[model samples]
Target: MTVLTIIADIRIKPDEVEPVLASYRNLIPQVLPEPGCLQYDLHQDNEDPAHLLFFENWESRELWLDHMKTDHLAAHQAATDDKIESLTIYEMTKL
Candidate 1:
C-alpha cells in the first residue's frame, strides 16, 4: 500500500476563520472513518490565526481521490466555499 500525505495550507477570510475552523473541526470525526483514510488533522498557524493547515493520510492516491468525492467532503467544501483566500495541496509518499 502507498502512504499518502497531503498538506493543505489555507487562508480564510478574517472574520470567517473561526467559523471555518469550527466547521472543519466538526467535520473531522465524520471524515476520519471513511474508507482508506488513515488520519485527518487540522492545525492553526501560531502567528497567524487566519491561516489553517490540514494534514491527511490515506492508504493510496486513488482512495484519497475517492474521499474527495464523498458527500461529506462536498458538504465541507460547500460550507467553506468562497471563504478561503488561498489553498495549497501537497502529496507525499514514504521513501
Candidate 2:
C-alpha cells in the first residue's frame, strides 16, 4: 500500500488572514477522527504571517480523495474562497 503525503501551501489575503486562520483551526479536530487520516497538522511561515501550510499523511490516495469530498472540507473551501490569495496542493510518496 502506498503511504500518501500531502502538502497544502496556502496564502491568505493580507486583510483576511486572521479570519481565514480560524477556518484552518476548525479543521483539525474534525479531521483527526476520520479514517486513514494519520496526520493533519498546520504550519505557518515565520517570515510571512499570511502564509499557511498543512501537512497530511493518509493511508492511500483514495482516502485523501474521500477527504476532499467531505462536508467539512467543502465548508472550509467555501469560507475561504475570497480570503485565499493562493492554494497549492502537492501529493507525494516515498521513493
Candidate 3:
C-alpha cells in the first residue's frame, strides 16, 4: 500500500475565494467514499488567503489514479481549472 498527498496551492480570484472554497467543501463528502480513499482534507493559509491546500490519503497509487478519473474529480478539475496556481503531489510509503 502507498500514501499520496496532493498539496494544491490553489489561487482563487480575490472575490471568488469564498465561493471556490465552498465548492471544495461540497466535494469532500463526494470524494471520501471513493474506492481506496482513506482520508481527505482542505486547509487554508494564514498568510495567504488566496492559497488553498488539499491533503489526501489513498491505499495505493493505482487507486488514487482511479479516484482522479471519477466524475467527481472531473467536476473538481473543471471548477478549478484556471483558478489554481500550482499543484504538488507527493507519494509515500510506510516504513
Question: lDDT of all the models against the reference?
Answer: 0.89, 0.92, 0.76
lDDT, candidate 1, residue 68?
90
Leading candidate by TM-score:
2
In order of appearance, the predictions have TM-scores of 0.93, 0.95, 0.81
Task: Name the better of 1 and 3 by TM-score.
Answer: 1
User: Residue 52 CA error for candidate 2 (Å)?
Assistant: 1.0
lDDT tens digits, residues 4-82, model 1? 9999989999889878988898889988888899989898989999998998999999999998998888998999988
> What would the per-residue lDDT of candidate 3 be over residues 2-44, giving only the tens digit for each residue?
4765545466666667777877888899989888888888888
Q: Model 3 segments beyond 4 Å from truth?
A: none
Off by over 4 Å in 1: none
Ranking by TM-score, best first? 2, 1, 3
Candidate 2 structure quality by residue, lDDT tens digits, 1-95: 88999999999899998889898889788998999999999998999999999999999999989999999999988998999989999998878
Error of 1 at 90 (Å): 0.7
Q: Record all residue pairs in model 2 with backbone atoms less than 3 Å apart, i.e. clashing.
A: none
